[model samples]
Target: MKAGFSAFERYKMKGRFKWIAAAAAVILCVGLLFACKKDKGKEQEDISESTEAQAQAQASGEEGESEPARAEEEDPNKLEDGMMRSYLSGLPVDEKIGNRRPVAIMLNNLEAAQPMSGISKADVVYEYVVEGGITRLMGLFENYDDLDKIGSVRSCREYFVYTALEFDAIYMHFGQAAYAVDLLAQDYVDNLNGLGEAGDTCFYRTTDRQAPHNVYTSASGIEAGIKKLGYREDHYDGYKGKFKFCDLNEVVTNEGGGSAKHIEPDYKINKPWFDYNEKTGKYDRYQYGAPQIDELTGEQLSYDNIILQYNKWAQLDQKDYLAFDCHSGGIIQYCTKGMFTIGTWRRDVDSAKDGNVDMAPVRYYDMDGNEIEINNGKTFVCVIQDSALEDIVLE
Candidate 1:
């Protein structure tokens, strides 16, 4: 009976060993399947990473890539060789810029003409002494195509004509000084004379003001005058712009230049001054202890740049009318971005076929002889006589 029990125990042990071996085989098979699944997932992740890298290379125009680069296309706001910039505002111009010439309108700046219309739209404004210790303004406009009215238009001076020609603008004036008459008669000089027989169509009188102050011109009248006079509409070939303007991202405050946080151009009558505003980044203008406002927009007229050009001048006649040394070099002050710079300006004079003097390009240079770079915005030029330059104040 003891021998039989020992054999039975040995049989039970064998059966248990067989069961443990089968369980171990099943565990090994499950581990192999998990390893295979992990390897397949890693292979798919590698392919996705490789595809993403190829796409990034194609976007950035990397070498050895067959796809076209996305970043190399031309910008719509940029023109061919920087032609998209407005000559007056120095800002981007999507319209036909050099395709059409600017219009320089002679505007009266007397106390009676305060709050004048259309000056706010001017891209550049010039204030200079005329007669009786007063100043006149020449507004150079690139986008005056849609304005309803421009000015209580005034007469043209010879120096002002030269200034207008520097921009190749259509000179618009109600009358002219004797000094300007010859220059205006030259074939190269395309002007709209408001005193001409065509004055009836180009200018009108408003009962609100007196005789001279009542005279006004509109955009339609100026356009009609240009067509009637048969003047060239587009800029002349080979016409480079007058200024070397900096990009919008650039701040060209001339280093070592004097500070111009406050500026005063001493015209005896208006007593005009400019104050730099930090918020607007513009120099707000003041005259006669009041803010100078534009009648059209009813907003204070302001400018981004101010230039004080000191030139030699003398009385052209007994009438106290003046003449400026427009062709010669002179002292210049370029004020922009709350800073002022000292420079010089000169223009080349070309002789017309009829032997009359025609204006060439006007250039400004720093003390180092490099062309002065202006900020991209509107400008106001004060043509101060050398004798009166001492009266200019800069703070």
Candidate 2:
């Protein structure tokens, strides 16, 4: 009877051990779950902080906003003729990332009553290192998605002025707008006479009257030109309709056949909402803040493959350049000698609410903070132009 009791006691001890094991497993799982939650929260906070920093930078028109606003917003500091300011009075020239502000100092030391053909006009001259070779024109506002900055006709005209200075062609980086074209007509003539250099003369903006392919020197012609440069419309752009050739993957991984040298590494990563992971060395493509799916594979699209497709449809050249407006592809394929980053503007405030403000319907402010009234709701000028060559065409 004693031996039987001992065996029974041993069995009960075994049951206790099993219960303890189960309890430990439960506790481990809960700890792991909480750890994961903490990590996720940290990542989210980092992203939020980064976003807020960019917002402050844009509104203040300075980097970091680490410093307070200048006591005098309107300082008399001017740039020399042909030289430009990076920000109106905010950042130094060439240091700014995107075209944060449309206004810039035209003259090195002189001020302008209004833009000469939409180019910054001042008597004192400022000089920048000439960049080279453009080949296409695009209208994209993806970079400006944060502030919803899609440019209008005036902004596009500003693109033309800078583009003319950068590329070899006379009609590459342009958009559709007659009003801007008229403004360019005036500005181009004025600058050529004064400085002997009309940087954006080759580009222009046209209105609906120039539709079906009038602007950008005829869209149909531009399409044909792209094909000549070896753009396969079907294979490129991932079979998406529209002959935009911004595939950076196809450009860098083309088995090295054509003018692929111009396209740099991971250049497409500059597009907004596109993420490049250095840890796993993978690219993430998103649409509307969600992973976009490949129609055929039923899987999330990879940035590598998508960029490869864009490169296939791209246009490449040394002397030519591209200009874009407010669309996605419009900005990525920056195959130009120089880039003209433009922001669009409409009356942010209602005229009724503005108390008859003296500002124009669409005012053109210079880098100096002086306002130039644009009565017809439009302004034009060269924001950035490259001097890759000496052969410039006059209109």
Candidate 3:
């Protein structure tokens, strides 16, 4: 009876040990599965963080690369209000000139007026044939407020009126030709004619020179004339600018471009040539075998830009008077610093305006149909007869 009881106790202890082993196996399997899931979750989290960091780095790099390029594309000389660039020279100024008018003074380039007064102060100077074979000059001045005198004023030509109107300028002349008189009388054209009723107030005679060559005007006189005429002080609503300009910081050497070290445009009257000075990066002006000096500055006249424009011309009536087709498109050569390129120029005529021809603006373009860019400084415009283009010499 004691042996059988001991056998039963042993059997019960073995059964208990079997159940304990099964429970330990189940716990080990659950721990292995949980470790795998935790490891996969950590791996996924690491991948997501790496992708986010890469995306942020790429975005930052792109912005950093584009900023400088964008700045270079836009005009570097752009400024805020109260400061503006001169339309003729591309230089900065304090006044907003869009509203103000330029003064276009007709100057005699005859032997008597060889060393003209106040010419160096002009922002732009236009030379073209008048009556006979002689050439006359029309000076466009923007900053002549303090100039004591402007010219030995000359008579106006019909073509010169068109040039003055391009800038919406206040035209000043000692007299007018028969063709120009009718055009100047138009309400759209604002002029200060020395021979007209306003002559006494707008011009004065200097004893330093003779009759017609002695007539001169000053900035104060011009201001008084503007007040008397009641002309608009600001630009017209739809008025646009004339030329495209290089940035102030940019230096246009025109490398690999055609050279323009010396340029001569034949006017037949005053044989003029411009010699480029490498040191000054400017062209010293010469006319009639001598350096043309302005009596006001006592320095030889110089220019940063020179435009030789070829236009269609005809002899008006039987007289020596000539007429230029100012509205027509024609060839032009642009010279800046010491380089040049061929281009074209046309007047932007708005047919909608009808008889108001003064509203049109002169536009310039390169051979590629893009606007020709000019250097920052004063400009000299020579209107050569189209048939006489062969007379121009350049090296």
Candidate 1 vs candidate 2, lDDT winner:
1
Residue lDDT tens for model 3, 302-377: 9988888887666655677776767657878777667776667887665213435455777777656776667788
Query: Relative to the unseen true structure, what is the C-alpha lDDT of residue 384 in candidate 1, on a scale of 0 to 100?
Result: 86
Q: At residue 328, what lDDT does model 2 achieve?
A: 14
Report every candidate's CA lDDT. Answer: 0.73, 0.23, 0.75
Task: Tell me model 2's lDDT, rounded to 2 decimals.
Answer: 0.23
Between candidates 2 and 3, which one is better according to TM-score?
3
TM-score of 3: 0.80
Displacement of residue 211 (Cα, Å) in model 1 is 1.1
Off by over 4 Å in 1: 1-83, 348-357
User: What count of clashes does model 1 give?
Assistant: 0
Which residue runs does candidate 2 get wrong by more than 4 Å?
1-157, 160-165, 169-179, 182-220, 223-271, 279-287, 290-395
The TM-score, computed over Cα atoms with residue i paired to residue i, of candidate 2 is 0.18
Off by over 4 Å in 3: 1-75, 96-98, 350-357
Best by lDDT: 3
TM-score of each candidate?
A: 0.77, 0.18, 0.80
